[model samples]
Target chain A: MKDKTSKNQVLLKRQDFLKGMVAAPLVIAGLPNSAGAKPSASDAGNNVSYLFDSTKCIGCRSCTSACNQINDAELFSHDRPLDLSERSRTAIRVFLDDTKDKGTFIKRQCMHCLHPACVSACPVKAMRIDEKTGIVYNDPSVCIGCRYCMVACPFDIIQFEWDKKFPKIIKCTMCKETNLKTRGITACVDVCPSGALIFGTRKKLLAEAKKRIKKNPKKYVPKVYGEKDGGGTNILYIAGKDFDELGFPKNLGDESPAVITESIQAIYSWFIAPVVAFFLLFIPVSKNFKKVAGEENEG
Target chain B: MKKSEGSLAQQPLFGKIALAFVLLGLIIFLIRFFIGLGPTTNMSAGFPWGIWIAIDVVVGTAIGTGGFLMAILIYVFNKGSYHPLIRSAVMTSAFGYSIAGLSVIIDLGRWWNFYTLLLPWRWNTHSVLFEVAICILAYTIVLWLEFTPVLHEKGEDSGIMKIGFIKSIVNKLNEKKDGANKLLIVVITLGILLPIMHQSSLGTMMAIAKTKLHPLWHTPFLPILFLISIGFMGYSVVAIEALYSSFYLKRKYEVTMLRNLAPLTAALAVIWIAIRFFSLLSEGKAGLMSSSGTLSTYFWLEIIAVIIGTILMIAVKFSSSPRFIFISALFLIFGASLYRINVYIIGYNPGSNYNYVPSVMETMGTFALISAEFLLYLLFLRVLPILPAEHK
Candidate 1:
């Protein structure tokens, strides 16, 4: 792109330089591999995890009700929230099979991944992740609600308060600021009557999930969901039905999306790349400015 | 500004019509503060960003790329023959970026908290939006300052320098003040550096979206692709602006200048198209172009527009016809603009079942922003020394 801007009326027209400009993308294509140190997802043993077993879940909406009630403490009613929204921290959905014969009850909330994209996507650090618990939370006051987090979330979990005069972003924080602060457990986990939802340290819950899968190989899916999904979610799932049918996003490989973005951004660490580029531009610009000024003086 | 660029006895008759759109925009722009985006925009949680982002901010900044490119040619490369076009291009860049910044403020849900961008602790270096916001903020100031010499010229002509306060400010900022103008190099250099960083980051912003943006638009080379596309877009915008002034203002067209520029503009379009298709093929996503329902139609529509624009430029490479150059550049801009629209809006597949179409107010909002840009630009042209004195 720069070569073509040469002053020679024939400079850009010179086939050799235009060829170089056209092929400039080759330099950029080499960036991803050559840019920076690649950091893999964090593996913290002490991080908290939520285990939701779809096969063990009842049709009752108690967990969803409790989540809404806990988050919205002013409310006395615990009526079931139909879906996850600005106020609803969690919801349970039914994915029915063919012929409407059988349905799997699935719970939905933020994945709170070890490398949550929302935390990375946030321009203002409004989306914050707990170092110990990996609880991804949104600070409403700091958010300049660009909703880039909603765009970046692989699960489409981050919700926006779209209808408000001054909107705020909403998503699951695993009650890190509320129930977990006092009760030492999430509201949904406390209210789940069927043992469908359980809470423990990330490493222990993952071990438990693997043990269950190993003990009941025929009954459970052989894989522990989220063990590698999107570089491992703190919210682990074990379901009998296909994850695609269970309404879980498919093929979120071991790499989190943030890994690529973070690495790319690191190319300009402390704004080194841009500063170098400015110097490169300066050398030519100042030289040319001298000539332009000299000509003006002569005129 | 030492002499006017063929000023009329009064402002052009069409200014009132442009002012009409500006007024409409002002009303809607005011309404956004009182009302919520839910009622005004068709955006839901499913589709968070709509035309305000795709058109106003993304495409809007691209329209200014021509100024950056022109500055590189005239100031950096010593293209004195190209000097006549510099002031107008810089002026366009200033207005384009100021509008984009304004659009961003209106689009934000908590725009007042944007001051957090200045806070070092809140700066997320990993976030592409952070880089984009910082660069745009800096560059908008650079652009206005780059065009400050014209303001100094205009102020002298209009006798506004009679005011002591303004005279002091203008004297300090004036570039024509002999040896003192050496400092102009920094502002000029920054103007080029900022665009390269922010425009590429605009593309990289979507790279993190991964599967959310359809495979056709999402590539590891997004930053590179965006930077190249801006190359063609930059040239075409300058060409179109000049050709437009020639026709309406009845000034002599920079036909020879534009004719010489034609081949480079065509080459850039070709470069962009080549990288785009190569990325599509190498990524094995070319298959999606044909199979992905209406998405395929949009993909072809965008690609075909650039191809046609390329052909038009090649056809007129040797010709001196102003009409042909105008048409070719217009097609090129349309294609380049649609390419951005496709990338930011159409080709972006948040997921199946998540759909968006800009509501009436949202559509008006985008039009209003563009209209406001033009309205202000027309006013500047009338008052300031943007266009150069035409040769006999």
Candidate 2:
């Protein structure tokens, strides 16, 4: 937006010349490149894999209990969690399928996406994606409690401590520190006797998910979970019924949130280039400005 | 400041009234410290930010862009004609920023540790807030230093020529004043660079939360939108301040320069609308813009205000009408302000679960910050030759 002080006046010759020289290329660079646009969901190896096959599971809340115990989360009164809450890091929400006439439990936690928006959105690198494990982590000590990460998370997995005078952001770390590292299994994965939840590398899990769908197309939902949802999550799921019936958000592509912001920010950063171009054009504009000023003085 | 001009220190009625309101606000602000954000503000977990963050800091910084815009025009661009406006604009920018700095203290739950941003080793490069904090701090210092010439002029005019204790201190500081002022151009450059970096980063701060913000506002272009609007707001503030001063002092308006300034304002407004238009269409949220009930109303209001402002400005371009110009410029400011508030809070939707409406104290705190700014502006212009000399 240009400043509004000079409404009716013509652009000073020098101003016009300088503006044209600097602004023309900016407009050119700002043009959208439709040809080079890529699919939103390709994983750059940032994902934490989880497998949940409803057919193999029972309706036990042991996973939820174990998660709470390991994380020292708030204790819910009821044995079963029908909803996802701030304090509850992970929960199994049940979905009743009308067409298939079956009950499936969907475990919800951080998707740990390949292009995690929280990590990208964090201005101070407070949220980081561990290269080795693909775990999305937040350093509380560095967090200013801005809560922008909470808004960026598509799954609404992140929460803030609003009541605290100085609060820390809270989210699931995938129990990687305890279960996967030392115990060789996650709290939820270890405790699930029904083989409902399986944990492994995203690549291995994705292949296994595809294999299950291929072996029995009728039994599975034909689509492998996390294959391309919001740029693909590390967690994969194979349900006996349709995924949407089990409360999965449908139509989420593998597109990373960071891409959109980067494109715009990239355009603004192009300010330096246009400015340099203006400098290149400066000699002519400066000459024109002096000439105009001299003419005005003569008149 | 000269003996011939007599004492300009006499307070105007408006200044006294403005000071009273400022004191009231300060008292209310004191109450906020004793209590907490919870007792004072409408902020919630769902909406962690409120008007203070959006209006007092974000919009305030943009409105303060006058100094930067003028600096670029005069110093960098070497359009020396614009230099006369720089001092007054810089004074306004200083007050705007200082108030914003105070608001930051109010906004922070753990403000004592704000100095943590200054720690070299503790730097968090990934944190946008950290960047904003450091830049604002440095810029405030720059603003005061830039206005040192006004302080020297004040001392000289007061007839403290003898090198007494305080006179000697002032003289020592003012020694080789031209060299000192020339050496400080680096600070001026930072003043221009820092606002650009931090103000845009303010918008980038929101870009991180893609899902939380309404689709109407949730674009990668948020930073650009913020930057442009600030550019527009900067001029609007200058226009407002100049006009108000002219009216109060009963001096002839700098009509020619102001007329030129109007077109720039219009251009920025048009640019902002264009980007918003494309961003919405490309993002595939145009339908939601019109269909979303409450959000749609706010969206329309923003659009209508901008359009009216644009038309008014264009009309003024063809022919000048003071009333129309004032009305249109006012509309432009209203539209820009609403758009900013909308992007930060109104357009945001956490979930259907929670709601936020600012409490009285929160509103009072914001008012208090503004009052302080107005009060300081009044005091500075009186004591310092910050305002340009009225044309004979």
Candidate 3:
């Protein structure tokens, strides 16, 4: 009786392969959910930051042109890229309300969030954050050109090199590889003669923005922008006008979309949830397919 | 073991017109390779992704869920009487997914580095698109494998396998067919598993967009909503395909089977409508459904169309005629496609001086991708034993 039962088990081994294949991914896939992509106070590494004061911006756009020259020294074109384009990395746009008052000129570039939506959105890690510098950057070589990063960025700074055959994402990289490396300052910061754009560690720049706002409450908005905006951007802004009047989104909450998106995505990354889901799906599908196959054999 | 005597191209006027559109699409598709996306498409920095992504990759794949949807119905739900419908449903998915995969390369700026997607170390699993890309790729391959029995059946008797070495492989494939089917039983489950991952991730892609997406459409439940929406969209296409095949190919309709499916899909659509409404109300954007300008117009239109389709789908269960099924399928397809287009395009305001409307060439590119799907479907129907054998 024992020999016959062992033979029966041996014969049933073929069915076991199917079950094993279905079960193996569950075993191989996941560990328990760990500490996820929650944001901490000092998450944006070392936090090199840029501070811009709109009150001092003369609307001359010299810094914009300087940004064009220093980032891609080979490109000769320096006409203001009406809206930032592949050729133009940083842009100074003049925003006017419905009243169309003598509009305020605000410069726009990558905000380089502490928890970047682009970093979270890039499928290939083409966009990433530098741990030492806390600067968000893009690696064109790894980008599969899915454009998910472009869709995710709340700042609307990221653009595509749509016209080129060998195109890359066209956005500000905070001059991490260029002027920031050799000269230790961005081209825009170096060119801002009026002291509108300044660079320092994030903690220093943020404190400086608050001091300026505190000293002359009538001259500046009381709030230091990016203190809690877009999951606390590395860029700080203190403007004469309200962010809403200045054509900035009024409610760029302290929380990043990255954190929100990541919390939801943690299940897949944790591995076990999808593995369990696969096993649950497998049971019914296998049982039903067998039932149908048996009937097909009969009919 | 039987086949249709005539292919789609054999139809008198309709066949010629389809072939012409497909040829036109092919020519335009090739033209894009030389000229680049900027000159050929109306996409800009303000609007990086346009119709190709919004329509073809996102919504097209939603339509492609027909196979997985049917897999759930026949296998998971144990509604095995719908078994005759399975091969054709899988064929629809096979064509839809394979074509969507092919056309996405045209949209990618760096098409040569497309191979980087396969490199494991490069993957950013935190990204919803990463999950979507991996799942779609796995599902597309699995979908084709699921159709292998159909291919084997056709190839065994067809002219091509008569070649010497090919014939030996075909015989080997034939001999292992039963074993393959058992394995495919596992695979079909995988096919079911993958779509749930990717289809929901498609919505998660937008969820990360935050304030860029209009408040009316944005919600934490987007993934669940998208997961449910595909059931109705997939079922609608399955219904449409059933009626179209019966009408055009001189085959009988799976009337009772399709009637059974309508209630399941309608139930899904009902859940879809309720969740969308409550998601709006909870998000406190429900009032914007009327007060907001053109955005509200599109939202109301999408909801009303789905509501009408849902009611008609419920009515489809009470009747035998295929007309209501076809009309309701059209409405549901329109409604679901409109919802996606609304989320991806109309409502995606990244708040800069940026705007987008698809260029003539961009629209043509979309038409070409769609025509390729049609051409493939017709060609497959001609070559493979996809439609059911006659009962008599």
Candidate 4:
């Protein structure tokens, strides 16, 4: 009787093992496509771009004051006018070479990358790029203030409202909901005296940047700052000095950080790996189950 | 299994310390809510994530991985003899995850808007954090359900029903015990699946910070590394908890089962170290180890801790001794936690200008959170059938 029962237990275990193997693949098939289903390319065409020429900038803090006034933001606790914070939407940082004679003023704000890492990092669609205008915006209503966007952003543009009871992410939106909506131009671009800042379609900005570089190769850095940096940014810069010397991130490849991780996720979420893992794990489970059953029958 | 595990001990000293910590933490939390994150935390724009994320959520959840590890061993691997360890591990995991969830709420700048995380329509499919959040939420619920059987078992065996209200609830729970047990198969499977997804997703969360994170700790293989380390930490936590319980509660030590687990723990630790070094070499980042910096120091410390812990785990003499096992478990937990801290904090360099250190209140808050977890754990162990019944 014991031998027959043990034989039946072994058969039951094999059947259970087979059932687990079959179930794993079926479960995998039901999972949503691992590749992000969003349309990636459509938003680029409509994106408004900025052209900031450091050669034309005169170290005047007018644009900084203009941005602060327009945004109705506060001064940073440290009271540094050049630093970007929740209270300061934009800043013009003055960089001097070792000689201290050559000073370059660079305007810094949100790059508004075409493939924004902040948008990809936000778990709740609080950070999003507007499909129509291609402006990156943060919705405080839905934001949990996880600060994941701040970490994901290579440019370090997103500032937090650390002092506020109900904090929100503060980043340049190209005056999408503010000055641009009513005045047809960003506050800083509209207020620049030296024509250093220009607001237009990304195509026009790129052409303008290229024309400047081609016309005066010696005067410009020979490359548009955001054209291919971090998978192309809406905000472009034509700096007289090397970007790395002026506090810009160095060695940033053209690929967005989001693409790197998302692709890995896609490969793993393809279902085959997980199914194989389940099958591998099931073997021990089946053997142990049979042994226990056989032992029970003997007892 | 249905019998009482043991009588509750008069743990006055522990109870007092836990209450004091909880009270202090509550006071700090009130200050934090009123004053905002800036005053209470060392978080800046450059250093947005602090210990709240690194210790509470990341390390806390890693420690909580005990339940899933045991589930994999018992349900997926079908090692039924390990069943005695499952309930206690599950309880610990449930508490760990619950504290992590609460820490997230406390850490969020806009805590009121936290419900947006639950709205499926707002979910970002591309975000790894989204997967983590959803999985954690689901797993916490599943863990609680898995724990109900313990409560039911306790209610059925313990006859001291002094309070009418309490007695009625126990009766209801006891009445549903059979149905709940039947449903446990599905719950256990889910409990196994959810942790695999989230624990790795936690690592993926750090992967997005490519340039900011130091090369020593940052790799594209972060998800895999995290999963393996978490598995090692999970077994270590189980070992520590088992040994501690046996010593303090005066119960029989499951030394033989724990001794059997030593090889598996050591093997996982070995695999983790191999993968970590191999991935670092493959990324051409092995040169960074010699850099004279805080990050390099922490990185070497993490590596040393793991090596020593693994060596101890595999050594026959050390693995056999309860004291050595406990010490090794501590080292493994420390190594795993430091790895997470290095990944999230030490290795992260937003810029030369930004610096952060946890404030006094932030430290107190973390302490309180841990103390509360211990208090709850003690309460559950006393009242629930979490431990195996002592043979009279």
Highest DockQ, which number?
1
lDDT of 1 by residue, B1-392 (tens): 12244533135655665667678877876777887888888887667889999999999999988889888787777786777787778878888899999999999998879899889999877788999999999999999878767767676657556778777778776645754465568999999889988998888888777767778888877887788888888888899887665554667788888888888889989999998999899888878989999888888888898899899999996687887888888888888888788878888766666799998888887887887787777667666667777773
* Per-residue lDDT of model 2, residues B237-266, tens digit only: 777776655554555666566667778788
Per-model C-alpha RMSD: 8.3, 9.5, 8.8, 9.7
Name the better of 2 and 3 by DockQ.
Answer: 3
True lDDT of residue B230, candidate 3: 94
lDDT of 3 by residue, A44-84 (tens): 42478889999889888888888888887777466876667
**Candidate 3 lDDT, B1-392, residue by residue in tens:** 13476534566776667667777777776767776788888887768889998999889999999999889988889988888888878989988888778878888888888888889898877788889888988999999889877756776668656777767756777788777667787789889999998998788789878878888888777887889999899999998987776665777777887888888888999999999998888768878898879999999899999999999999997888888788888899889989999989999887746789999888877887787788778777767788877672
- lDDT digits (tens) for residues B1-392 of candidate 4: 12254423345765788789999999988988998999899999999999999999999999999989998888676687787788889999999999999999899889999899888799876688888888899899999887866655565346545667656766775678555444565566678777998898788888888879888977777888899999889999999988767665767778788888888998999999999999889878888988848777899899999999998888834445777888888899999999999999989999988998899989989999999998888777766667876652
**Candidate 1, residues A141-194: lDDT per residue as tens digits?**
888988889888888788887787887788888988778998999988988999
User: Would you give the TM-score of chain B in model 2?
Assistant: 0.90
Stronger candidate by DockQ (1 vs 3): 1
Question: In candidate 1 chain A, what residue range of length 10 has the lowest lDDT sum?
Answer: A32-41
Give lDDT per model, in order: 0.79, 0.68, 0.80, 0.80
Task: Return whichever of 2 and 3 wins on lDDT.
Answer: 3
Given candidate 4, what's the lDDT at residue A70? 72
- DockQ, prediction 4: 0.36
Clashes of 1: 0
Q: Candidate 2, overall lDDT?
A: 0.68
Return the TM-score for each candidate structure: 0.91, 0.78, 0.91, 0.88
